[model samples]
Target: MANSNGSKAAARDKRQRLTAAAAEVLHRQGVERTTIADIAQLADVPVGNVYYYFKTKDDLVRAALSAHADHLSLKLAHLDRDPDPRARLGALVASWVERRDITARYGCPTGTLAVELDKREPDGIDTEVGQLFRTLVDWVAEQFRRLGQPDPHDLAITFVAANQGMSLLSNALRDPTIMIREGERLRRWLDDLPT
Candidate 1:
């Protein structure tokens, strides 16, 4: 029983590590360019073992997307600890600024993946990938609602669009400073909103 339990724990850890590595590799290399061998190498697991955890590349990709969603949720939950909705929005911008360099290099993880997947044949993966933005927009809209905004959803869409645009430009120009500058402007915009 002890050995069985230990083996189960070890297997779970390896699966988690593989998924985490998949996310990083997919983020850096894009979905079409990444291979199972690359993910296994990054995870330090044998390539053959990857199949033990994931039956196909799409399955692994799904796992990676799920991981990204989980991370996003946790980050939003952490931001929600702030009582002020405006401040929460500011913090969201601040978090983006914090990741400016990476976003500049990788073009916003969710955005890049969504674009790549959307280009592929209709497999429902594109729609699944789109939920990431929906999650962000919904969360942002909730914050605006808390601030008594008349059109919370529209405002949320504008805010997210601005951020996504900033990310795209920063990545295209290879300039992290774009994110910082845009973040500052977003912060000011949030501050100017009616309480």
Candidate 2:
């Protein structure tokens, strides 16, 4: 029984490692350029063992997307600790600024992946990609609603679009300062909004 438990734990660890590596690789290389081998190497697991965790590359991509969603959910949950809705939204923008260099280098992970998958033929994963955006939009809209804003959904959409647009421009321009400057602008915008 002890041995079985140990084996199960090890399997879970390996699966987590593979999923994490897949997310990183997919973000850096975009979906079309990443490979199972690349993820396996990053995870330090043998390529053959990757199959034990994931049957196909798409399965790995789905796992990455799910992992990304889980991560974003955790971040939103953390932001929820703040009492002020505007402060929470500002913190979200600040968090993006914190990763400005990475965003400049790779673009926004969720945004880039969604765009890449969108260009391909319809797959079930595309729906999951949409869910990521929905998660963000819903959370932001709720914050706007808390602030007594009309058309909270529209406000949230604009906020998310601005962040994504900044990320795209930063990446294209290879300039991390764009994220920093935009983050400051967003914080000011949030402050300016009437409560």
Q: How do the residues 117-141 of candidate 2 rate in per-residue lDDT, one tens digit apiece?
A: 9998998898899999999999999
Cα lDDT tens digits, model 1, 74-162, are 99999999999898999999999999999999999889999999889989878887998999999999999999999999999999999
Give candidate 1's root-mean-square deviation (CA, Å).
Answer: 0.7
Error of 2 at 149 (Å): 0.6
Counted clashes in each candidate structure: 0, 0
Which pairs, if any, clash in model 2?
none
TM-score of 1: 0.98
The lDDT for every candidate, in the order shown, is 0.94, 0.95
